[model samples]
Target: MKFLDHPSRNLFFTGKGGVGKTSVACATAVKLADSGKKVLLVSTDPASNLDEVFDVSLENHPTPISAIPTLSAMNLDPEKSAAEYRERMVGPYRGLLPDAAIKSMEEQFSGSCTLEIAAFDEFSRLLGDPAVTAEFDHVIFDTAPTGHTLRLLTLPSAWDGFMSQNTTGTSCLGPLAGLQEQQKLYQQSVRALCDAATTTLVLVARTESSALREAARTSEELAELGVGNQHLVINGVFQAVDTTDPYAVALQQRGAAAIDEIPAGLNAFPQTTVPLCPGVILGIDSLRRLGTLDSAVATDVADESVSGDDELAPLSGLIDDLVAPGHGVILAMGKGGVGKTTVAAAVAVAIAQRGYDVHLSTTDPAAHLEAAMNDERLPNLSITRIDPAAETARYSEEVLSSAGANLDEQGKALLQEDLRSPCTEEIAVFRAFADAVAAGTNKFVVLDTAPTGHTVLLLVSALAYHREVTRQSSEMPEAVENLLPRLRDPDFTRVLIVTLAEATPVHEAAALQRDLRRAEIEPYAWVVNQVLSSLPLTDPLMKQRQKHEQQYLREVSQQQASRVAIIPWQLQPPTGIQGLSRLTHCDLSTSPS
Candidate 1:
């Protein structure tokens, strides 16, 4: 509510995934509109949850929300924008180019780099072009961009360097000559971001070490980009009103300690805290009540629930199904903050317990794959991270040696500058992802992929990965050149889509499934993480939340996913091998105390 004290035309809420950016943005927009201001609430997340939060469907264009007066909202579909961008770039070549040439161009446009570039182009126009948003008094953005991507798009130096180069016929977004017209507009946008009077940036995070650290990094990066006016919103803060319940006490203490030991970088910013609530924040009424929930009395208790263990299948049911293949690739992917890393680690541990060799890895920037599982001592399982810093260094050296060896001073300087672009990191990380996939040929490779919004659309992302593999190695490695075919082959790959038992996560996971199917990859199963129905909680709010989860459980089993596995929320997060194995019911596991 304090964020409303000083209003700016543009408000940006950004942080690591699942930090309540969407909820906070929606609530702020509703409040501002209630105060009689014309507002446009926009979500640039590829996996937008505005529709779930507002209870009204929204697309790329503004749709008036019936529940809120003077407010309009839109969910920018980056995949759609990327598709349109590809058509515009390749449409002119129809009939003039051979079938193979046309296909190649299309594949290039389908790369993750194309998604990032096309997304930024749309983002710039939305912020830069005055005519496009002249109707609204304030524009609030719930952006799903990573810190790396944000730097590439908003930093003045990044654009300046790109403009100075002869980048035609080089990257995913087409010839550099085509981007000339947007330079001035981009510059204006950068100026607007830097102007404290016009824009306010809010960094959202959870009261957890990892989340706070990410917030700190983002805060530092954005400040360097000239967006100096910033506020920090630490969401999901819990306080144990029920001292008798050890679970509640432990939970509160953990959060309190995280706040007590705040990230150093965040110390400079003003901070606001939002209370943790069991009930999902959806609809106008819930949005208004967010962060205002009254503390539960120590004696408050409510018991109302419904479940059949056989009906609501546990994650253990799939052990045999998953291990049956003996060896292949198992990819765990979903929206941010959905516990994909935990689930992936659990599955790997479960499979490896069966005496098969497994390689566990991740492409996520928040590399918690190791932190999620405790027992790395298992000889059957090995873990690795495709770290951005190390990959960027290796990639930069390779590019400088091969691409810049013969360049003059100007060309060499430009090439070096280009290598520093955040997009370069995306490329380097992507190459590493490909290398990890290749490892699946010999053993069970468990991949904890990045969250949906920051990663490329699953539908087209696997395109020409095989061709790229061949290009990377003269004597191509043993890995399959065509990643999709291998993935499509039931004998070679399986994907487990992880999501929460909530409206937003369920809908997003459904969308993920649609995209994966389009890529000819079928999800072997869906893991619905964090179900309150499976636990015993003597709390009124928790009981209400349990009621809400049943609807999603039915939705998941009956409609959203063809095959499913459900993991109950633990009193504590499953952080180590023992905790993780419990989720999968692996042989080495013991039940959580």
Candidate 2:
């Protein structure tokens, strides 16, 4: 609420997944609109649920909503924009090329870089072009998860550097030589982003140490880029709503302590704290009310640790099914911000502590797996990351060389242009993923996946690309060739779907499950990370909110997965090795038979 005092026209909201970026952004936008300012709210996130939040469908262009006289909203579909950009880039050479060459070119454009570039292309037009801003009093951006947003912001420089070095030529990508007008726009966009006076960067985060540290890091990066006008919003700072509830008091104390550690650098900035709400933050009404944190829930903090002698409960039961001998892989899959990486890392730590040789790895673009394992002495656990930039670059170069080695200057130019599309990264990353997944046979392989949409696409593309590769050549690399079968083998892989108890994360996790089933990958367990109900409460309102979690918790238990595990809300935020290790309770393990 204090952020209103400064009143900047350009606002950005970014945080870890499920920290309520959308809710906060929406509420702020609504509040600004209520004050009679013309507002255009844009979501650059590929996984945006702005339509759901506002209870209306939104697309690439701005849509009028609320009849609020001056307020409008838009949900930018980066995929659609990327597809359009690809077509426009490749349209010129449609008929002159061989069908095989053309198909190869299209495949090259499908990389992750292409999508990023295309999204940036659209974003640049809106942010960099002064004409676009003439119609709005304020432009608010609800960004993707932190890692993706960082990549998105850093792309201009990445593309600029790449473009500066590469000469125009045809390689594996046929018919496309290089980027044309996009380079210029990207340069301008970079300038716009770095212009501190015009663009104000708002770092939205929870009271947790990791979130705060991320905010600090982002501040430093943006400042180095010359965008120093940064503000921090510490959201969901809670206090006990019930005086009598000891559990609520303890939980509130934990949250408060976390909030107390808000770095000194951010203290000087306009800081506003929203309270923990009692119910699901869905639809406009709920979103608008999120700014006014309701202290409606409280519950007694039950001792989260299970008795070592008592019959192993459902939580331990799920882990038992998973760590059972001969299950080649245990994959952690879920929407961003649901603690998949943490859960995956914890599982690896636990397994390795038990003497299982475990390969804990991640295909997440913003992988924190290495950080998660820092200083831990789990001799049996090792970590690997499928670095998208590295793998995608290698894949692109290989494809170009193999497919278009003999093309002439013009033909190669066209091929290069065709390959410039973003779909290419998806293919490349997926290939590396396939190779990595194949390693699960001899060890307990744990995979922390990308976000919901990207992960689903990754799985689907495996089958689809395998089919394509089979058509291309009989001598496909062993990694590409074996992708589908490895994924299809249930005995070789066990999927653990992770999610928060909230509506969006839970719904998204459920959707992810549906996608996995459609792809014939059965989930091994469902982990509801950071559950507060298991903790004690003292406030009446906090107790009410905890009570409300019963329905969703029940739903998660009954409908989300046949087997489930609950991690109690910790009194301290999870960060670094010490914090992450605290998650692995020895009592959570089943006794050896």
Candidate 3:
């Protein structure tokens, strides 16, 4: 691969979820290790699947991959890291402080901001402190999806600016009272990332317009952050060998068109393309074969027919069940790149067409709800986004005008400084989410949430804030106070776990379901999107992929969800009212032309 030709000391793989970031990173690491270089692979994603990819158990510290002698890997498990971080921050003051004070400090550390900082602390230690990784020849980072990854990468500058400008001794970045001591380390990390000689950022994407568009946006954003040493890896570029199969031809043509219209921002970088594999990339052998032209198609085709297609229901069946609830909140959530926005929009349109008022909104930082709608409008349907920047600004203005109105200039300055902390966005977005949920009382509200990691954080924040609201009942908003109850209430909230019939997305969605069940929020259904099993295809590669998808589909229907919905792969991208309506109107037996 071009990205591996002259690898830098620090290599970061990042893009949309399910775009094969982990696969590409593992393959690159394996190739380098085979070349007699000592390598350490680290995953900073909250929902890291490095363990699954390597088929080895992982911890926060590096564990040697038994299959590869030269490679060691680790997962920066955010929950565990946050627990340790909280203990470290509060340990020194445990016996000295009163019980109430200690509890308050612990509560402060429970927010999502603390989890982010804790994870970054671990990341910074590896990148900033050279002596810590002196044994490894190369360090590869398999970062979280685009939105979360950007937030993690930009923290050094964000925190530096906040700390430098703040005259007050404290701010909302809770549990990091010793942030000043780590200032030098953060600065070093920043310098390392920006220095082209030390670090290379590989932007991974699939051969689809949406995936490529996201990659372009990420490329430009990182460039603006001074990390201009960028490379683009267009993964899953398909070429059909069977000219007669319509499905195969359509897939190839769509990919070619997406590449032909490649964004100008991504064109500036060195580019590499990895062909679509016939089967899921798992195990060390498969990882080694990745990105090689010879292994693009499977030689041994499975002649055994796939069964259990008749047991699965269509997307409209799920919509029908959801509509039975009448007016309530519907959340389409799962890993990124699994068509969550499209599913949510389709459900919203279906409901609005049923003569009910519907409001569709998104909390995902990188969501393109408008693009998904394709400028189509319904009289009963309204769409909005919980934009972090706008919400934070509005929140800050409200706080300053109400609480800072009577304060002196210095006090007001401190109040404004407190509001400028990065944690403020978390609070602002949470409130906006709660307000959006509150609207369900009058009409249907469908929310397209962020990718798995961010969605998990949002839920965790809800739990933490609920505790705070219970203790300080007088100051909390009515919407905030009622958020958890509404989420946990089965009749009020219906969550559809959206995923593709692929290894990583299916496993990640399963993990997400477990998380929700633990929080007493039951998923109403599971949506298996982009399945190819029902298509009539003669291409060996397409047939291999179809055979591979059956297991995951069976897994979802039989093991994961009580109710399951299947959406077949579409010939065209599903956008606009007409395209979206087809999702709700078509049956599983029908294939798109």
Candidate 4:
């Protein structure tokens, strides 16, 4: 593959969740190291499974991989970085500040965004500072999931805007007293990212429409920022292992169809395809085995079917619980790429098929729900999308008119500046989401909420208005006033924590469940989406993968709430109404467990 052609320096791998970016990136790094080049593999993902993959623990500092002489790896520890960032921010005032004051400062910087920015700060330091890369022939970065990555990559302008405003105030992000120099470095780092010679952007996609579409969107956005030296690696490309294998034939057919419809917009980029591997691409051995894929497609596919009453039982049970008479709201809230939209659509279809009036909506700014529907005809379910840009624009106008109309030019500039933060978009979208959730009182409402970190921040921000109300003694806006009350009523809302039968997704999902409980929103059930055990497989390679999947399956069954659902792997794409119907009634138990 072209992305692997360079065994040294400047490799960037990115993709949607579950598309094998980590595996592919690791394999490339391993290949380079085995070729006698010193390779440094780093993961900026908060839920990185690098330790599991290498079968060794890693800290922020690079640890030798042991499997290869020249390869080393590190996982950027967000919590530890956040702590260091806080210490640095408040260090100068150590003698002047009280212990309680310092504690408060640390608490203020303890939010999810602070952790994210701190991680980004470390990444920029490593990537932009040549000193860090001096000892390595190659630096491979396995980025966080898509949404978080997009935000991280765009931080240069975000920090620059904050610096230009120079607002002096007590804020939610603690004392911003030490930001000036950091902001300058941040801008420089962003420039470095966009410089094609210094950076290469790789978009990883599966042979699925949604993944491809997301890649196209990512390419366009990144290109606009001048990060145009890009390559497309289509992972999980399927080819029939045997002509007589009907299941494998069906998978190849479906995969080919999806690739045929690859968005014409992404045609400009250099592209490579990876062939399907019959087994899970975990551990250095498996990755190296994949690296010898000469004249091989970069695609790796899993279309296996598993047999067990347990596999099909979970989905049926979840359906029964959701089939009550009175209408209520169902929110599929969990980590990104955990199949929330898929589960939400399936549940909405399941309930609507039972004759309930259902309205399925998504607050994801990316608009994955519309594509999930696939122009399929639905009998009773109505799909609605809350556009973040639209909501933010309207909310910004309202806030400016009501609060900053009389301000001078400098003050107005600050007002516009504060409004530009992505946090403003979150607040605006949360209000719209609240309005949509409130609409569920008389009919069934299903929401595919923003991912875990974003959702938690949104809910926490809802409580901010209450704090603002008590401090100002002013009546709050109608939208802000109604949010907290509506969300807190468990009877009115049921949250489904969706996850994949995989280590990273399930671990992140568990954390999400805890966060939701902290916010007083208990998840109704855990839906383990896309399990190989639900699908039957005759291939030995696929059978080996099933064994690997067992560990994660066990984790999901043990970690989630008592109520759980499992959707089997489908050979065909889960697009349109008929496909969704299969997911609605996913009962795969004919094969051996």
- List the candidates' TM-scores in order: 0.86, 0.74, 0.91, 0.86
The TM-score-based order of candidates, best leading, equals 3, 4, 1, 2
Q: Write the per-residue lDDT of candidate 4 for residues 506-574, one digit (tens) a residue.
A: 777876777676777777778877777655566544555565677777766664666667777776667
Clashing pairs in 1: 374-576, 374-577, 466-481
| All-Cα superposition RMSD per candidate | 4.0, 6.7, 3.2, 4.3
Top-lDDT structure, candidate number: 3
Which scores better on lDDT, 1 or 2?
1
Q: Report the lDDT tens digits of candidate 2 across residue range 529-577.
A: 7665544444555555555566666777777777777765654545555
Model 3 spans with C-alpha error above 4 angstroms: 144-170, 364-367, 450-463, 466-475
Instruction: Write candidate 1's Cα lDDT for 1-593 as tens digits.
Output: 57788888999899766677888899889889989999999887766878878889899889999977799999887778888877877788889999987887777565566676677667677677888899899999997345555555543433444544553333323344435556787677777777889888888888777778778877887787777888899898877555665555666778898899887878888888888766667788777777675522122334544563237577888878877777788889886678888888998888888899999998766678767875455888899888888988897888777767877897777667667767667656766776777777788899998424334343344444533322222233343345546667877778888988876678778888887776667788988887766665544545555676788889889987778778876767787778787787632121336
Any runs in candidate 4 off by more than 4 Å, and if so which?
94-112, 144-175, 291-314, 334-338, 374-380, 457-489, 534-536, 589-593
Model 3: lDDT of residue 120: 72
By TM-score, the better pick of 3 and 4 is 3
Which segments of model 1 are wrong by more than 4 Å? 55-59, 66-68, 86-108, 144-146, 150-168, 294-302, 308-310, 403-411, 450-482, 586-593
lDDT of each: 0.73, 0.65, 0.80, 0.70
The reply for model 2, stretches above 4 Å from the true place, is 144-179, 260-270, 282-313, 325-327, 335-337, 349-355, 361-439, 448-484, 508-522, 533-538, 550-563, 570-593
